[model samples]
Target: MQQSNAYIIIFSVILTVVLGLLLSGTSEVLKPIQKKAEELDTKKQILGAVVPAEQISRMKAEEINQFYESRIASKVVNIAGEEVEEQDGVQVTAENIDVAKNYKKAPEDRLYPVFIFHEEGNEEAANAYIFPVYGSGLWDNIWGYLALQTDMATIEGITFSHAGETPGLGARITSPEVQQRYKEKSIYSESGELVSVVMQKGEGKDYSGEPHKVDGLSGATITAEGVNKMLKNYLEHYQSYMERKKEGTPKMALN
Candidate 1:
């Protein structure tokens, strides 16, 4: 039997509305779970800056959060490395800080998140300082956490992620091999200048012999350069904080 056009239109409208309602209801019901999962994912990424490559993927969400809370001290800092108590009366914390949002603001106005990982029992001193950095990649945004050694000049580890980079090329930024390249690299010159680590062509040099240069992805030059720029810009913002640490200042060290 052939349906009349009016009847078909009515049926289509009802179906569309029903489907839309169902989707909306599902999203609303799952919103909390989704938010929890996102929080867990961010925790895992932050952990990635400290955890070993083999263990990062194997750790559960609960374990990640446990380690994060116990071993990490998070705080917000301005460009001058001073801890910020509140911005417009809203407390600034590591979990609450939106680094990407702050990036759009002026340098002094930006509030950066810093994660200090220390021994479980000793929160007074940091073993390393992990910083959050983000910038444009080949396709979209790329971001990561960079862990600096207690000296606040050498990189301990890195973990990068992207919104949409080509597979096997720019995407290699997240690979263990690529990330390993950043380990032990120096981000400052001996003269106290902020000369961030560079991504050079080809397999590059042994970082132990050449501290500031690393092997970039073979075919992902633009993405590699993006990483370079992102690191330099973000690290510069923390240089004041780092200098204070080197001088035995109590801003980030005591808390």
Candidate 2:
């Protein structure tokens, strides 16, 4: 008792529609959870720029969120360093702006996010400023957060992440050992030029005396170059904001 072609066609259509609806419903159900997870991860990465990785890793997701809410405050700015309250009718926020998408636009057309880490209970007094940077790596995109000390010139801590890169070579950028090398490094020269820190040509060289250079990844020169360019580009983008803050004339208050 074989089914008719019309019956088979009708069954197929019904099956397809049902499957599609099921998938759509499942996606809708999971969307919020996925978003929460991404938000949590982003907070962890931002915190990674200032807090120790081991410390962050030790905490639970709820703890991470609580800590971020209590200590971090953010603002959005443009290339000219003016505070941006809204853009194209949408309220701008440091957490909402996507750095990777902004990287695709012309520098002057992009919005930058500044995450300020304040004292435990005092939001008015900033301890460090964190900025996100994005660039191309050998295989794919690379990005990171750089936290500058209160002076806005010296690096407090740094954290790097990649979309895709060699496991042990270029991927080393995310390693604590590599990032630790950038701590205390200055992004400015003695003459006050914003000569952002450079990842020199090779690893194991003495850059201890060089205020603006760090050891390159062992076998990842291209990735190192990517990191170098990302830092210089984003640092320049944020320079005006830093200068304004340093001179005590920031367009917006820390709170």
Best-fitting candidate, measured by lDDT?
2
lDDT of 2 by residue, 1-255 (tens): 459998999999999999999999999999999999999999999999999999999999999999999999999999999999999998988999999999999999999999999988788788899999899888999999999998889999999999998999999999999999999999999899999999988789989998899999878999999999999999999999999888873533543
Task: Evaluate all candidate structures by whole-model CA lDDT and list the values in order.
Answer: 0.87, 0.93
Candidate 1 wrongly placed segments (more than 4 Å): 1-5, 204-208, 249-255
Measured with C-alpha atoms, the lDDT of residue 128 in candidate 1 is 87
The TM-score of candidate 2 is 0.90
The TM-scores, one per candidate, come to 0.92, 0.90
**Poorest 10 consecutive residues of model 1 by lDDT?**
246-255
- State which candidate has the highest TM-score: 1
- Residue 66's C-alpha lDDT in candidate 1? 85
- Stretches > 4 Å off in candidate 2: 1-19, 249-255
